[model samples]
Target: MTTPSGPTVPFALARFATDAGSVPGLVVGDRIRPLSPAELGAPSLNEFLAAGEAAWDRIAALAAVASDASHSDGTTADAAWRPLEAVTLLAPVEPRQVLQTGANYRTHVIDLVAAGRAKDDPRPIEELREWAAELMDRRAREGIPYFFIGLPACVVGAEEVLELPDYSEQHDWELELAVVIGSPAFRVSREDAMAHVAGYTIVNDITTRDLVFRQDMKDIGTDWYRAKNAPGFLPTGPFLVPARHIADPGDLRLTLTLNGETMQDATTGDLLFDIPALIAAASETMPLLPGDLLLTGSPAGNGIAHGRLLRDGDVMVGTIEGLGSQVVRAAAARVPA
Candidate 1:
């Protein structure tokens, strides 16, 4: 196996549905080199990822070969490679465990706090923002990332639609950068965290605003189990860009548009707790197995902050720099006739 020629020659990992079954592939430009059972030892990314970083290194090397061959003579003798457009793109990884860091973005938390202020409050927007900024700084200095578990069943590929549950009109969108874990992590230090990461992908954590908190149990706090666990709620991936390709995860830009209008425009620089911090903190209590996901929180500019929740027929297009784009359509859950 050969290593990637250089970081400039980009490569992504993806999954596609074939007549035989689901197949994981190496993405080079517009073409794909599908993996065989002998290549990765499994048909699923989750299982293959369990083989760990060496497996990933081998794949990257193969991608480099494919990348060079694709540009060199315009044709390769290997029949395994196919056009990306000819296949259906599935979620890049089948995470055995999915954990999300909540309110990790400095500005997003501040915006939510400011927006929640009562209309009768005498404080001006400038004062509120200053106070929020200080609060965020304090959190970053003294606090660790807040994490919550998510059901894997809620995950769906980019080809799926976001079926807005009829139970709540307060449906909202939160586009985020997701970490795909490779090496096992257990009580690892912050400095060693990145070594465990396999790559990154995009996930839109849809929520039912009304179901986020229980009316009768105010002291018990947020009900994330109900608020964020809807089927098709977590629409993920056109592809997964291995960590080697991303120059710096913290320097990437995130953009999401609702029905062709920009709703979220921010950068990873706004994150209060970086990826390493999140991984280190989360793995402290539990063993993070291969192919598990750790989602960095969303940046500012969600539906509730703008008072413009998702609606039927609304198309949500989310893109994170170098991670590819996701186009998810929201619609009212149809009742059976």
Candidate 2:
């Protein structure tokens, strides 16, 4: 299919339907061009990304040539060009490891702390704000990024339905920018971190609020596994935009709407620890492998902060500046009698 004359996006790697089944494809405008078996070499997106930087460069070059040819021909229809809507969009890549940052956004942390303190303190809002600001400042200066492991079994496609666990009532949404690793990283410095990133994708880190803290074992602290690792808890990807396409990861906007009402709207600029810092911190303990995902923490205005948690039949639309949007439906978890 011929494309319109404009700035051609090199490629937006995606997995879509083909005659044999779903395969990795390169997205150009509204159509998808399935990667041939030879081109794929690797069976899955995970393996494809792990094939190294030269592999991605080759794909991008091939995509650029096709895009240029399409522009020159100006043809609108081709058998190879399938409309994006017609194909099933799967999670761009199945990461071997999923690591999520906790309390990485300044405003998100401030809001939670302020709300918790408001229950006991008689101070005014301004006073609380002042105290919270000081606390965050100190944390930024002294604290390192806190990260937790996430199970890859919980990941689902962009349009997948999320079954709210029956054990929890306060299901919530946490829209975040998920970083995709291109190369292995071990105890890497912040200066060399960007080189390891393949691209960016959106991940809605759905959490069950009531399950976050272990009531019976307070000393153990948060139980992210139970609260977050439910099947389909992570709705990820419509596209994995190449890191080169995004000018600055720290400057993108993130927003989420529940049933058409905007809930969380913030920018990566508010992040207390940016991508490079988060990468460095996470790699300090373990190696970050190719196709691994690092979820930068969500911004403020989550269900806990707004008192409007997710409910069955709710539709959440999460959007990040250049990464694209994800629409997921909430369903009641079925329990066997």
Report the lDDT of model 2 for residue 42. Answer: 71
- Candidate 2 residue pairs in backbone clash: none
Q: What is the C-alpha lDDT profile of model 2 across 1-337, one tens digit per residue?
A: 1111111345788876557876888887766778875776676677677676777777877677666667444434446767677787878877889999999889898888776674668898778878888888788888899899999988778677788877878899999999999888999999999999988888999998888889998899999988999889998887888888889999989999888899999999999888999999999999999889999999999999998898889988888887767888899988621
Report the Cα lDDT for residue 178, model 1.
Answer: 95
- Clash totals for all models, in order? 0, 0
RMSD of every candidate to native, in Å, equals 4.4, 3.7
Q: Score candidate 1 by TM-score against the native.
A: 0.92
After superposition, which runs of candidate 1 have C-alpha atoms over 4 Å from their true positions?
1-9, 41-44, 71-76
In terms of lDDT, the poorest run of 10 residues in model 1 is 1-10
Candidate 1 C-alpha lDDT tens digits along 1-337:
1111111237778888989878788877767778876777666677667676677777877876776666465556668878776787778788888998888898898888887787998899889989989988999999888999999888888778788888778999999999998879999999999998888889999988888878798899899999999888788886877787788999999999988899999999999999889989999999998888899999999998999999999988888888777888777888621
